[model samples]
Target chain A: MNKYWHVVGVGIQNTLVYRVNFLFRACFALIPLMATIYLWRAIFASNADSPQIAGYSLATMTSYYLLATIVDALTAVAEDDWQIAADIKDGRISQFLLKPIDYLAYRLCLFGAGRIIYAAVAALPATLFIVVQRSHFLLPSDGLTLVLFLASTVLTALLQFLMSYTIALLAFWVLEVSTFIFILFAFEYIAGGHLFPLDILPSALANALSYTPFPYQLYFPVSIYLGRIAGDELWRGLLIQSFWVATLFGLARFAWHRGIRRYAAVGG
Target chain B: MNASSHSRAFAGWGLLRRYARLYGALWRNSVVREMGFKTNFVLWIFVEMLWFALQIAFIAVIYQHTDRIATWSKWQVVMLIGASHFIQQVFTAVFLLNCSNLSELVRTGRLDFLLLLPINTRFLVSFRQVDLGAFVNAASAVAVMIYAARQLDLEPGIVQVLAFLALCVAGVLIHYFLMFLLATICFWTVRAQGIVWGYYNLFTVARLPDGAFRPGVFKTVFTLALPMLLVSNVPVKLLVGMLESPLEIALLLGMACVCFVISEAGWRASVRQYTSAGS
Candidate 1:
């Protein structure tokens, strides 16, 4: 446990080294957010027939994107998957195998530390953007929603990390896994509600997406924040998210066990 | 023409021919390299195709509720998005990878080798690698454009198509110069990937309808300053017959020229600032 705490400390220092990178990334993301806000504003403006399209008023839709950005900032895997893939491909994981360390636990610590630094770095810009659009930004209506949203977001971060780690484990078999990563990312981008809220899709399509882990990765938490799912539905959604987390955890462990059997290190 | 001027013109033409042949060699080298990673190459094309399909799907979803978005019909908006994708893919095919790699070159001091080469350093650095995979996505974008044209019931003449292609070249040039300018920031910093990627994200603004932005600071900045709006909007407008004046086309061409000049100057300045990464 102390060793893992040391890993977290080291990870925090490593992440801080790229503080400038994080700052610029967080600042520049506002450009696309501006476009999305304007695009939605235009969409809502064009529809004179009703104040809501797919049950999203302009204000609520605006909040959706803002919250989505915040959620993404908190949970995005960024290049961790690629780094993991590289470690496997280049024989760096051999060190972990020989040492008394669990690679998955070590990576989870690094991810947690990275996210803590990243979300802190991004908070300023995100707050500024939200403040600038304060009229449209919505907070949770009640204390339970806030607590549940926080709980679900932690699950989301774990689920995202586990899924990415599992995919990166494919490096044990394939020479290149970037395309696979990107293909998954595209699905996650659209299905996870990064591009837009899944609720905007037809009910059948939206309902179908809810069963996928992609939605649980992002949309579920953001929706919880929006109070879109409530009472029985909220509890059921959290339960589903937990199930996916547990399932992916098992899958990740299984992949690591199998992959280690065939792993070979070339360099001393 | 005077004899000296004639000799000067001949020498310039000779330089252009040599550079063209050099570019051909670079493209060949990149093709060979890409072939070495065959699965990666094919999968990238498939990944990009999935992304482009999602863009169209998102448009379809939007149009399901509203008839028009800021004066753009469903098909017209599709055309606009397709045009943006077309420009982006072409730019990616030709120059995107090379520009993105500039930071790595600077970091490793591999740029020293390029600077020592006999050829023009900027040309060599900017056009050294092409991603043939992106051209496959470019073809998919053209397919969407054709489908959108069919839905709009428009029959564009040869001249219209040629003009659209010409403007797309201008659009690609604009993106190349903008990205090159951004990447040249690598000379001043250890790494400028974040900033370059930020500019790439900013290019998403090109896909939205120009009419969506109200005339104000946002409009002025993206139009005349960065010129994101002009990249695809002006070309698509001409193709869809929404072009109100010849001046819009003129503005786009003129902006392309301005961007080129600025990018060239910035690259030169950054090169002057470059101190090789030493042991």
Candidate 2:
């Protein structure tokens, strides 16, 4: 337990040491926000119809984007896949294997600690941006909704870590994982609601995506905060997210174990 | 004096030949390296194809909701996206990876070996790797542009196509110079990826119609200062026959030239200040 705490401490300290760089990165994240805003505003202004599209008013739609971005920053998982893949490729995993520490716990704890700092630096400015654009923004007032949103955000991180780690474990089989990472990120960008509100997607497409885990990361949480999903639907969404975390956790473990066996076979 | 000038001209031609050969060799080496990971190569192509498809889907979705994104027809926007892909891929293949790698070189002391080379360091660094996958993606983007033009009932004259191609090259140069400027900051920051990424996202707005962005001062900043908005917009507009101002072409050319000069000067200054991994 103490060792895990120490790892988390190390992560926090490292984030602090590189806080300036992280702060700059947070600022950079705003560029995409600006682009999305510009793109959507164009869509709305030239709408030539009602100010609403697919049941979304311009203000509510813009608010969705703003809140979605904040959720994205909160749930953004640092890519540890590169480090993991390198460790596998170069026999660096042996050090971790020799330790008594649980690898996932160590990785997740360290990652979570760092992101706590990252979310701090990013979320504040994002919230202020929302406040400045308050006319177009909406905030959930109910305590229950905010708690659910927070819970979902943390689970989203866990699920993302597992997803990335599972993909990284493919290094045990593949010669390289760079393409996998790129494709996964691209897929996430669309399905995860980074590009636009998932609610804006075609109803059939939205219904189909409900079965997938991608929306929970950014879409579901943002939706919850906007009170878009309410009552029983919110709890069901939470249930679905938790379901993904459990499933992904299992997949990550299986990959790690299989990867370890193959790695050992090669080492011998 | 006449004989000396002739010899100097010959030396310049010889230098060009040597660098050209060097670039060919670097590309060959890169292709060979990628061949070892054939699956990854194909995957990169597929991944890029998906991204392009999504961009199209995004455009389609918006058009379904409303017509004309700031005076851009759906087909015209598709053509613009295709031009954007071509420019971006060519930039990535030729300069993006190269300049992005600069910070790594600076950190690892490997840049010492590059600097100690007998030829120009910028030339070597700028053409270090050739991404074949990006080249394939670029060809696909050209196909998209041709298809979009056909759908729009537009048959570009040979001269217009030539002009478009030239402007595409200019756009690519602008992109390269801008990226080079960002990467050169590594000499002081030691970590310029954030700056590079920040610039990249800002640059992304260039692919969109200019009318979509905030007008007045903010737009002018991107138009002149960073010049991000002009990179793909000018060439696409020119090709689509939507460009009205001859002055816009002049502006783009001037921007490209100024960016090249500033980037080159900045790179040299950064090199001068570099303490190097040894220091």
Candidate 3:
């Protein structure tokens, strides 16, 4: 546990050294957010007579997207699989295997370091967006909403970390994981509500997604923050998020242990 | 004079045959390479199918809240998605890998070897490798397009089909040029990965209908600066309706000409820079 702190320190140093790359990547968050804002603004403007569609007004939807972008920045992990794949492919994982430090914990610290950097880098753009669109911005209506939101968001970050780690473990068997990574990213954006609010989705699909881990990644936590998931739904969303985190953690551990058996297959 | 005309026609035919042979061998090599990892290929195809399904689901979700996004109806949007998949998957299959690798080649000085060959560097760099999995997705996109057309209860006539095909070809060209432009930027910068990735971030908008976004600066940029809107939107519009306006034709042609000219010019400039730098 104490040794992992050093890993985090190393990751922070590395992140700073590559700050330009990270900031360039973080700026990408603004592009999609603007696109969605313009999209919703159009949809709302064209149907100005309707006060609300699916219980969200233009202002609330805009605010929802703005908040969601920040949450995305906080939740997004570093590109973990490229290094994992390279390590597995080049026999470098063997070096880590001989150490007392666990690979998963090291990755978690690195992910933490990335999250911190991303949050700091993303703050400038997010603040600018908030300032320009401050009129449309909405805050948590009450203290409970804010608390529940924070809890669920932390759970979401953990769940996302586990998910990525599990996916990275697949590199143990394959020569390349780029295709799978592409597929994972596409699904994550759609299902995780990074692209749009899940509530705006069809009730049937939204209800179905409620049972899955995807919505908990971005939408549910943001909804909790926006006070959209009130009372029973808030509690249910939190429970479901915790459930996903636990399951993903276990799954990632299982995958790593199972993946190690193939280390010899890398050909001694 | 008759003999000269015949020989000229034969020379043209011979050039065509040479290109066809080149394409055939490149594709065969790719197919054989993927065959070695048949399971990975199949897995990728499966995952792509799943991604396509998820996109369709997203559209269904959007339509549930409203009848139409703008002028485009639900099935029309689905067609846009299908067309987007078709253009992107086919582009990925045919052009993506080679274009993406251009920057890497520049970095490692490997591009020098290709420049040494008696071939067009653009030609060699543009269509070298194929992702057969993406080829499978392109085929599936046709099925999806047909299904969406059925849902819309519209049978495209020959005119509409021809227009759709032409617009799609134009879309592919624009996409290739944009990517090539990104790749060419590597000549100036040591690390151009961010720009390449930024292009991808911008591309997410291309898959959506033009009507989904409003008449704003962002839309203006997508329309004028990038013209990503023309990639999938115009083709779907043509299939659902017809190319009803002359303006649409001009926009498509303008986008095609602009992107093609700019990317080609940039590539030549980059090559000149590379040679002068003595790389």
Candidate 4:
């Protein structure tokens, strides 16, 4: 346990050295926030007299996007699986395999470290900036809802990591894993509700997505923060996310085993 | 001077053939690499299909609430989305796969070998690696565009089709230049991979209907300064007979030309700054 903590500490320290990279990442994360502001401003301008859409007021929607931006920043998994694949390809994994530490734990520690650094430097600042600039849109509401939002956000991150890791394991068989990564990224834009709220989805499609786990990874957490999902809906969403974590965990383990068995380190 | 000019033209043609051959070889190797894990390749196709379905589903949901987005009708928006994906695929196919590899080349000093070659180093490096897998996405997007057009019952005239094709080509050029400009920044900052990722986020705004943005400062910025909307919005509008103004077409062409020149100059500057991996 202490060893794991030590590893995590080291990981955090390592990430802090690359401060500029993290800042750039945070800046990039703001693109969605900017787009949403521009889009909602247009919508509000068009419907100046009518600010409400479905249950959300224009201010609520804007705040939702602002909160969603921070959620996205904190919850988004590491983007580079190519590095891991390269490690496996180049026999670097053999070094890890021989180490006393668990490879999975090390990778998780590294990711957590990066996320922790980002949360401190970028996500928090961006969230504060949004609140400061758009304080008028922020509705003072429930502490309970905020707690649920944080829980859902952490679970979403775990599920996202599991999904990505499962996909990355395909590098064992595939010479290049970039195409798979691209496809995953494209899916995240639509199903993960990064582009728009799932509430705005058509009934048939929303129903279909509800049966799947993609929304729980992003939409559920964002909805919680926005106070769009409450009480029974929040609990149900958490339960769904837990189930996804378990299922994806199983799949990730299976892939890792099968993949690692086939992985012939090509270079020293 | 005349004889030297003729030889240069002949050399240029020979270099083009060599690059073509290299591209063909890369394509074949990529196919074989993919075929080695046939199931994975098939799974990738399904994954892409899933994305297409989700995009259509999102559009459908939005259209159900409102008949129009900005000034774009449901069909027009759908066509635009498909066209943007088609244009995106062309960039993914031609340049994106190689951009990451170029960083690796610079890191490994393999770039020196390319520079020492008789061929144009820029051309060789740019086209050396191609993502043939993106062809599937391109084909699917084109099919979606054709179907969307038919569903809208829009019969494009010859001139419109020609303009659409021209705009698509220009879109590809603009995308290439924009990406190359970003990638060239890597020469200065060795680990500018985040810039590539950040640039894609910019495309998220671009993929949406340009009509959603009011004709103001923002519109001018997007249409001229950044020109993301010109990548697909203009092309789709022309095909749907919505863009009739000569000014709009000229603006798109002008933006493409500017991006091309800026990106070319940036590439040359980056090359000059490059001192090979160890140095």
Candidate 5:
């Protein structure tokens, strides 16, 4: 446990060293939000006869996107996969195997520490953007919604990390995993409601996506906070999200075990 | 013509031919490298195609509700997005990797070798490698643009096609200049990857209809300051026969020229400030 604490400390220090990079990334990540605002404003204005499009007023729609931005800032896996791939490729995992440390737990600590700093650094700019557009921002409907939103957000972070870790485990088999990572990222960007509200999608398509884990990543939590889900639906979404998280965790463990059987410390 | 003037003209032509030959060699080398990683190439094409498909899906969803986004029809907006993709893909194929690598070169002091070369440093650094995979996506974008043209019931003449190609070249130049300028920030920072990617993110505005940006601070800044909105808007407007005035043409050309001059000057200044890693 103490060793894991040290790992968390090291992660915090490492991230602080690149504080400027994170600041630039956090601020620039808002550029897409600006484009979205202009785009939705145009859409709503053009269809003035229809006050709501797909069951969302302009204000509520903007609020959905704004909440999605914050949710992403809090939960998205930035580049942990690439780092893990490098570790596997360079044989740095040998150090962990030799020690009492579990590599996955070690990584989870680092991820938690990194996310803490990232969320802290990102909160300033994200809060400022929300405040500037406060007229369009919506507060959580109630205390239970806020609590559930937080819980789901935690699950989102875990699911994202587990999925990324599993993908990086491919480094054991393939020389380069960038293409695989990028392909998944492209799907995540579209299906995760990062681009738009999943509800705005056709009911058939949205229902199809609901079965996938992607929407559970960004859309489910934001929707919970917006009070768009309740009672049985909310519980079902959380159950599905947790199911994905648990399944990905098992998959990650299986990959690690199989990969370790074939691991050669040749690079090291 | 005087002998001195004629001699100078001959010397300039010789230099131009030399640079053209050098560029040809670089392209050949890049092609060989890309061929060495054939699977990566194919998968990158797949990745880009998927992204393009999703973007089209987003547009389709919006069009289901409203016939027009602002004053532009559905096909017209598709044309604009397709044109934007084409410009971005072409720029990616030619210059994106080069600009992205500039930071690493600076950080490792590898740029010293390029500085000692006889060729112009900027040209050599900016055009060293080409990603042939991106051209596949560019071709897909052209297919979409043609499909959009068909949907709009317009058959562009040869001159119009030539004009469209000319404007695309200008758009690519603008992208290159802006990215190169951002890349040059590596002289001050250890790595300017985030800032350069920020520029990439900001360029997404190019896909949105120019008319969608109501006249205000956002429109003015993106237009006159960043010049992102003009990169794809003007070319598509010309192709769709919606170009409002000659002023639109002037603005894009003027923006391209201004970016070139500023980036050129900025690169020179940054090179002067660059200190080797050892120093």
Candidate 6:
């Protein structure tokens, strides 16, 4: 356990050394922010006098998107899994196999470390910008709401990690995973509510997505932050997220074992 | 003919043939490779379907709130989305994915081999890796366009269809130039992976409707600084009669030409700066 924490520390230090690269990444994440602002501004302009659409005011929508951007930054995970799969294909996983550390734990540590540093340096500042610029937009009515929002954000990060890692592990079987990943990313933009609120989805599609884990990974957390979900609904959302995390965790383990068996048989 | 004009024409034709050959080979290889991964192909098809579903859901949601978005009706917006996808597919199939890998080629000195080829280096490098799978998406986009046109209950005249196709080609050109202009920066910055990622971020703006940007600084930036609107929006508008002014069509063509010239200059400068990893 201590060793895992030490690995996380090392990862954090390593990321700090490349701080400028991380800043560039944060800036890149802001592209959607610019897009959303333009989108909502147009929405408002079209209606002109209307204060609401689909039960969300322009201010609320703006805040939702702003928080979505911050949530996206905080959930940033390692890109090493695809590289790991490539390395495994090339028989380079042996280097990690020879190490004293557990490979999965090491990856988690590194991801945790990067996320911690990123949250502080990038996510925090971006969130602060949102809070300052759109203070009036937030409807944080109580302390419990704030606490639930924070918890949901943390769970959101873990759920996203599991989902991405699971997809990355598919590379063990797939010739190349870029196309699959691109498609998954496109789905994430819509289903995860990063591009727009899931409430905007058609009733049929919205009901379908509720059964999936994508909404919990992004939409649930931002909804909590925006005071859209409350009381029993908030708890229900968290339970769904927790269930997904556990389910995905089991699937990831299965994938890793099967992938490694294949790797060994192929002489990786 | 003058010697210069004759040589220029000859060189252009030669370059075109060389790129076509290389693109053909890459497309064939990619198809064979993807076919071998049967499971992946099936999964990828499903994923593409899911993407189309998601886009449909977005349109559904927008329509739920209002009868129209900006000056365009729901069907018109859907057509625009289809046009955007078409432009994206064409560019991705030919150039976008290849340009994104420029940094790796530069770092490993594979770029030297490409440079040594007898063909024009820019033409060759830009079109080397063809993603044949994008054809699936392109076909899907065309289907969506037809469906949206049907929903609108309008059959575009032959002249309008031809103009739309021309503008779509111009849109693909603008997209290629923007991507290449950014990719060429790899020559100076060896670690341009972030910049490549940043360039995709610019696509988010391109994906949204042009009218989503109000007439102000945002419009100015999209039109002049990045030209994101001209890539898909204007072309789709022209098809739908939302933009019927002759001047608008002329301006879009002019923008495409200017972007190509700027990107060509940038590519030449970057090539000059390319000191191969090998001696």
TM-score of each: 0.98, 0.94, 0.91, 0.86, 0.98, 0.89
- Order candidates by lDDT, high to low: 1, 5, 2, 3, 6, 4
Q: Of models 4 and 5, which has the larger lDDT?
A: 5
Q: Give the C-alpha miss distance for residue B218 in model 4, angstroms.
A: 4.1
Residue-level lDDT of model 1, residues A1-268, one tens digit each, is: 9999999999999999998899999988888889989988888899877999988889888999998899888998987899999999888999998899999999999999999999999999999889889999988999999999999999999999999999999998888999889989999989998888898899999988887899998999999999898999999999999999999999999999999888886452
* Docking outcome class, model 6: medium
lDDT of all predictions: 0.91, 0.84, 0.82, 0.78, 0.91, 0.79
The list of candidate 5 runs beyond 4 A from truth reads none
- The residue-by-residue lDDT of candidate 6 on A118-141, one tens digit each, is 777786558665765664367677
- The deviation in Å at residue B182 for candidate 6 is 0.5
TM-score for candidate 6, residues paired by index: 0.89
- B1-279: candidate 2 lDDT, tens digit per residue: 999999999999999999889988998999898898887788889998999888888887777777787888999989988998899999888888888888999988789988899989999988898888899999999999999999999888999999999999998999899889989989898888767766667646767888687676658878998777787888888888888898999999999999999998999899998877864
> Which residue runs of candidate 2 sit more than 4 Å off their true CA positions?
A265-268, B1-11
In model 3, the Cα lDDT at residue B157 comes to 85
Clashing pairs in 1: none
Worst 10 residues of 6 chain A by lDDT: A76-85
Ranked candidates, highest DockQ first: 1, 5, 2, 6, 3, 4
Q: Report, to 2 decimal places, the DockQ of model 5.
A: 0.78
- Per candidate, chain B TM-score? 0.97, 0.95, 0.92, 0.90, 0.98, 0.90
Candidate 5 local lDDT, residue A141: 81
| Candidate 1 Cα errors over 4 Å, as ranges | none
The number of clashing residue pairs in model 3 is 0
Please rank every candidate by TM-score, starting with the best.
Answer: 5, 1, 2, 3, 6, 4
DockQ of 2: 0.65
Q: What does the i-RMS of model 1 come to?
A: 1.0
Error of 1 at A118 (Å): 0.8
lDDT of 5: 0.91
Candidate 6 regions off by >4 Å? A78-80, A92-100, A120-136, A171-187, A202-208, A257-262, A265-268, B1-46
